[model samples]
Target: MLRFAGFELDQRRIELRAPGGEPIRLRPKSFDMLRLFAANAGRVVSKQELMEAIWPNIHVGEDSLFQCIREIRTALGDEGRQLIKVVSGRGYLFDAEVSGDPASFAASAGLSSASEQEGLAQQAGGHAAATVAGPAKKRQFSFGLRSRVAAVIAVLCAVIGFAVAAPMFAPGVVAPENTPTITVMPFVDGGSDPQATSMATNVTDRLADGLAKIDTIRVVTPRSDVTTASLANAPTRPADTDFVVSGELQRSANSWTLEARMTNAATGEVKWTTSVAVDTENTDLALQQSRLAAGVGHELAVRINAVLYPRAGVASPLTGSTKVVVEQALASINQTTRERFTAAQTMLESALANAPDNLDLQVTLSALQTRGIQMNWYSAAESTAAESAARSRLERALQAKPNYLPGLEAYCRFLTATNNFVESLVACAKVLSLDPWNGSALYQLGLTQIQLGRFDDALANFKQADRFDTPAVSRWTWLLGIGWANLLLGHSEEAVPWLQKSIAITPASGRPYMVLAVALQGSGRTDEAKAALAKAMVLRPGSTALNVAPPKRNASPVFLEAGQRFIRTLVELGLPAG
Candidate 1:
């Protein structure tokens, strides 16, 4: 018997009873649903999961499941939707305070008793029926005559039951797992120019995004903690944050240099540090900033992973025959020119050919493919080929070492692109389970949740993504995600600032303009909306402004009210908003 919320369920009897001795009658299916939820309390159960659990072999309609849920909720005195929240279109979640002594429940359920076990199994109904079907059922009676068969079966079952029951008396087992955390400080701007400061912030943001892809580290966001002044003075770490990353920028004639350090917050010990210098005179400031950001982000991710996992051959893996090749590849990646990328690709390929099964080589190849895609150095067909190659390589890497974080993240991205959202979400969840501070995984997962119509989950993920401050590209993407999520959540006003920040960073891009237009239109700023839309058209001709499908409509009254408001704004703006 398990007790919770003033009710107790007897698994053997398959009955629910109140503290005062009244029986709460439930349909056979409703009772099963309640039992599962009670067993796995404090966890979010998706609708797909519930369907699979309760109606495993049947093609049951969602309405049937929902009816059972309604009946169960009514019996529990949960009148409103608040008790068991319907998380948008994804599934229902039960939220209630629960307390039970596991040992007491185990004893009361007679977990060690063969009779109790048999009764519980029989009470499970369909499961018992399924188990007793076909060849297994025949095997029980074929060897004996009718008179002896039942007695023989009884004796054999008794032996088997004792064998199963013996293990229940053993001590329970639980293992301790380390949870790694990291903090990303604001990027240091060596120059006094406002543009430079903004560039630095963007760089830090991107780095944080990249690092968050790793599954063994938690990244802290600078947006809510570190600031411009704090970067210079190295302020104390926040109580909840784990690691702090601080860096310095210095100008040297025509070149700019950046020195960064990652420190453990608890001990104030430097975990890793590196200095990078780039020529800024000939390169545009923005491009230079992006290059620096990518380089810093990649290196920081490597260092953090090493510290957290400490795998063999992770540090200085190419000390023997592949040393020169590895160095060449790394040097090429550090360069900003197209020629350098080609050289890096060649060197990485050679290294992989030499060690075809190497995990590091595979990861480097995937990273190169990502870079090529981002830079547009590869044509559309070429980019597709490159991504396919990367996916194949990452899959091989995972087969070699299943826990490889970089490989897992790369594969997850590929899966997402292929519209395998369920698997991708699971992979990203595993990444989070291993390392909670991974910003890239969080952002990607957030986007996937939004696609799945899990708005609240998407919002939560975006909020978490905002914690890391590394790399300018990641910063831009994170801000863009936040802006879009807010718009979807009907917070048009909150989205404006985020979209504006993105536009400020990438003025030539069409994305921010499109989002800004939506926000403007939503806010009833008709003239501004037209202007913003016009700019977006100019930026990307034949863009899909209103062509995308809207999110799944909810049954909430608030959504209906918002829809009315949206229509009013559309009328004011002189457009067919629907």
Candidate 2:
């Protein structure tokens, strides 16, 4: 027996008991997890380590592990979250003092029953008993017949299962034959200034390096400087070229600008183009080259990724009319209003129904639903359905396109919301490594940082997202993040404008307004605070001092304390006590 926190894990009896000696039921997996925790009590258990221990050969999703976590927490009645503590960006820890080598205690409790003792003695004397018995050839023949029949049945079942599931698993087994090929011609320096020439060369180098990291596409970066007009006007393109990427850099007043485009080489038609500017005045010279290159490069990469992996590489970006419907869904991701969310969901569902295998629509809907789950728009049953559908779609999408930024972003957000921060952190970093200016990924990263109590890092991440401001639909999310971080950091006055900007762009989210109320209250505008709170209450009905509070799980003590104070302020301003 091992004892801690008024509970005893009786290994001999294979059960857990509360202080009152009542048995606590647990699923087999949950019991395994609890036993693992008991063995390593008071130690931080990394998620990867835990998964490997619990599931040796199986490649299960984090959801399985998260379910077990929920089970353990419920069984322990760890509402305060003191027992199973989450170490943000790390893993989980079962923090408690446990007794060691309590075999005598199990004996005292009579957990080692007489039947169990007899079974052990029988096992020890089994070989001797077998010698005294006959060979029993009749029994052997009967067992062999059954074994052969079972083997035949198992073989048939395996073949049928493989045939049925091959498509689902094909992405990993088979290499893609239709992988898109892209060529990056060296960017032309549009200005005569030496600074502009240097900027062009740096961006040209970095852009190629960045594109090379994408596994889904084949990138060819030519060394020789090629004029943008040459690639645009030339009749011939490389024989294998599917797309040609060419751009020009110029130094304008106080900023460096990059005008970049991707062209369909075979059709001699322009595919995509964008203009990006990096402020020389605001950014130090050291980081300017990266900003200029990634600004335009990130956009082009997303466009290329969308064309190749129409399964929503970055926020479920689609290519055609389906894209328009998907964009409606993306809107809910940006604004987060309950009505808009439902409407967008209905639209996507209808569109997806028309084309059930549309992987792009699947992931887009998944991403949208993840946002709904984050906003608590789903009931218990609804949340389960939403999470299940989204998880299936995301897993399938990822299996198909591992480098798709949109899918990665969605999965990253899913893991973050599930309190699986360690994997979420890695996912966010992967998105950034693929496209450094990915605003969606940055927003998710900032969220993780906030939960970790790294308020300053979170603020910087949000601010960086604002600066890059790529994929403009996701603009409001980062804006809200910045304000949220500022409020957490106690710079309430500074948080006001950012929060207001976020609300202006996407006024549907009651969360932003509720947070805005905090900023206003902290700024000592009592009347304005009450007004903001009223609007928030109107936006989100049935909110209370209790339910309105953000979850404390995995959030650092500093963040929890700050959140408590913010909740107290909201209550003071008129939030209900329920």
How many backbone clashes does every candidate have? Answer: 18, 3
- Which tens-of-lDDT digit does each residue in 154-264 have in candidate 2? 234333433443343334322245667777777778758876775676566556645654444566654354444455454645566688888888787888778888888
lDDT of 1 by residue, 1-578 (tens): 66777888777787888878699999988987876666545555544445545665344433356558767866786643345654321235667665654344434322323344333333332221222221111101111112223334433433343233223211211111454656667766767977667566555644554454343444555544445344334355456566778787676678767888877676677778888776777676645554565456656765665565454645335456566765666444423346677888987887788777667777777766665654456766897899778867766665544555666666655544444454555455444433344566777777665665555556666664554333334566667778877887888888888888867766554546766777877777768887876776566554441422222232234444543454454344443443
In model 2, the worst 10-residue window by lDDT is 136-145
> Which residue runs of candidate 1 sit more than 4 Å off their true CA positions?
1-304, 307-361, 364-387, 468-473, 506-509, 534-578
Q: Ten consecutive residues with minimal summed lDDT in candidate 1?
A: 136-145
On lDDT, the candidate that comes out on top is 2
Score every model by TM-score: 0.42, 0.60
Candidate 1 whole-model C-alpha lDDT, 0 to 1 = 0.56
lDDT score of residue 563 within candidate 1: 39
